[model samples]
Target: MTDRHNAFLSDMAEATRLTQSGRLGEATALIQRRLGVPGRSPDGASPADASAGPHAVPRLEGPAARLGTEAAAATAHEALIPERLRENIDQMMQGLRTLAPSLRGLVGGGLHAPKPGGLEPEGVETEGGQFVERSFSNAAGARDYKLFIPSPRSGPRPLLVMLHGCTQSPDDFAAGTRMNALAEEEGIYVVYPRQSSRANAQRCWNWFEPGDQGREMGEAGIVAGLVRAICTEHPIDRSRIYIAGLSAGGAAAANIARAYPDLFAGLGVHSGLAAGCARDLPSALSAMRVGAPGAAEPGGAAGFGAGSVTQNLRVPTIVFHGEGDGTVHPRNADAVLAQAGIDALTPRRERGSSGRHSYTRTRYADETGRVQVEAWSVQGAGHAWLGGSPEGSYTDPSGPDASRAMLDFFLGHSLPGGRG
Candidate 1:
């Protein structure tokens, strides 16, 4: 393995221990101190925004705090880090400093090979990017995944668990969002869990399939498996871990969040619907308009977080839909909110430019006091990434900086109670 990979694993392993051993607060303090709010990039972008740091992230208090945020540049400095935690994080980051040279990368996913100029692992560095691939087994068989690490100056950095939309590969999703590039600027780690195309046509995850929405058997297990792997293999601050996806991938992501709320700090849904809300495409479409079939009671549609959301967890969420979205109607966004039991609604705030309609966030509170529902309706957007990709389709790069805004939210929330 490359030195960068080795070092990243080491950090994650240590962080995992800290959080699992009930030292989450200490771990957070330790990580924050080491990475120190990431400095600006060579071209002068801005400080690397680590996933979970000192920010006003959404707070979902339950057995374990599991909520995140989408706030802007938060003002946290090295001075705020506790002395003891800083010392430990400093020591851990020192050895990995030498592995920066081996952190290059390759963009695009699925069956396509990385291009000639594409990033080469352990070679041409992109500021600094590090990641790890992992997997697990289920009744459906076995599955694998990837966890991109940001070489933070501070550590125990927050993590972003990215779920790819249907027919989309982790590599393609990474390319379009350039989230890894953003990680360099923000000093946060990015985790990309790929859904096997063999499982569904069009390479879409079985989010609409009931088997995938449950806690034990299908897609939910795969997602939970990835989370478990990350917890076992990295120094991810449990309170700061977040999830996001597009299209069917977005729907899968929402399902994962609602099903495993304890596992995700926050969630971002782009061009997708809530899973198990319907059994098929036709029913899924109908549920998107109103509530799930027979879900007419006040809390009828809000029960998706009972297990699949993450071992019966409740976390913050951010949903994105295009008013003109043809594939998945904008109404689906509402269906997602209702099903997740999110009751708060932020006032309508929108802005339009050129061919884009940008709908702002209206916060909805969940039973745990966390903002359960937050939606971003891109009036003219489509069933694709807001930002464009070189080899990826169904993306609109010219639109709002979805990656940036998503990161802002990712950094905004924290895990309830604390993981370490």
Candidate 2:
């Protein structure tokens, strides 16, 4: 093997170890530098801009230095990161390249990176509606959120809580999904909760952690608290609240919705895994690569922390996944559907095209013929918000309009005694 290839492998192994240790910032920094991304310092901060940049990678010492030796390094590389995982690692790094520029502006209190299409910054009042910023704090913790209130507020409006993916901010998410634009059309309220980098270096929700997976705890508690606070302050209908997210955010949305079924009437999970799919970094990577182990067996919901997975979904749910998504395997989408134990034989299927991409949509109904779960599988799309705008990050604009579809599905159902 070439010496250069060996060095690359060594770095890849180290990056994998860092990721397993939950030091994603350092791992991101190392990977970003290896990719030759400009404007970033070795510590993962941008020299020109403190707000956006990669997280710093720390030097190995003592016990950590064993990986520097050829023998120990080989063993660690072989044992911890198998040959099969290399492809996934490469794909993830490539995704980082696309995400790096927007990332510098997203972290800490840095100025937002410039919007691609010269769009207005997030939370700016536009012609369509008023975008307002707010904060919520409870015993669990505190979080910042942006609320999009439609221009014409006639009565109690339905609310949608949006969670952005890693390396994303509320404004970036708003621009990508264009959910705020849809809110203007439907006369509803949309809120995007900002995940702080202090909680996670990449600003991803701690979905794989045991504490964050259950109801009234960790990130779930904070998000639920935010929703309650919004409902109390605004003219929101308690019965018509919903939540949706993408990638890491998507997994979090599943956990939050499942944890607090009483708070959310419906859920939209795009390119996400099932709730409690993984309890740690190793299992999380495994679940993202494949479906959660034993997820199909009866009573397989153990190790899910406080709550066990139930057979039926308490809240109406819809899912979206790209067939070509490399960062997260498409089977995770199936796992999300499988969590509800929907019968495989009953779904009604349809094939359609959204401008450039082809898609297959499957709908599953309850005994009353109410569509309780829906899945959209888009062809040729990757780990991005399908049919999202180019103005934001991590979006593919040519696929099906997931924002609109999710809105339609969410509006179709409400809590009991609610106007559906």
TM-scores of the models, in the given order? 0.62, 0.70
- Model 2, stretches more than 4 Å misplaced? 1-127, 296-311, 418-420
Off by over 4 Å in 1: 1-127, 131-134, 138-140, 280-282, 285-314, 340-342, 345-361, 364-372
* Top-scoring candidate (TM-score): 2
Model 2 residue 4 lDDT score: 75
lDDT of 1 at 90: 59
RMSD of 2: 13.3
Lowest lDDT block of 10, candidate 2 = 54-63
State how far residue 419 of model 1 sits from its true place (Å).
3.8
Each model's lDDT = 0.57, 0.72
Against the correct fold, how does model 2 do in TM-score?
Answer: 0.70
What are the clashing pairs of model 2?
Answer: 43-56, 44-54, 52-104, 53-104
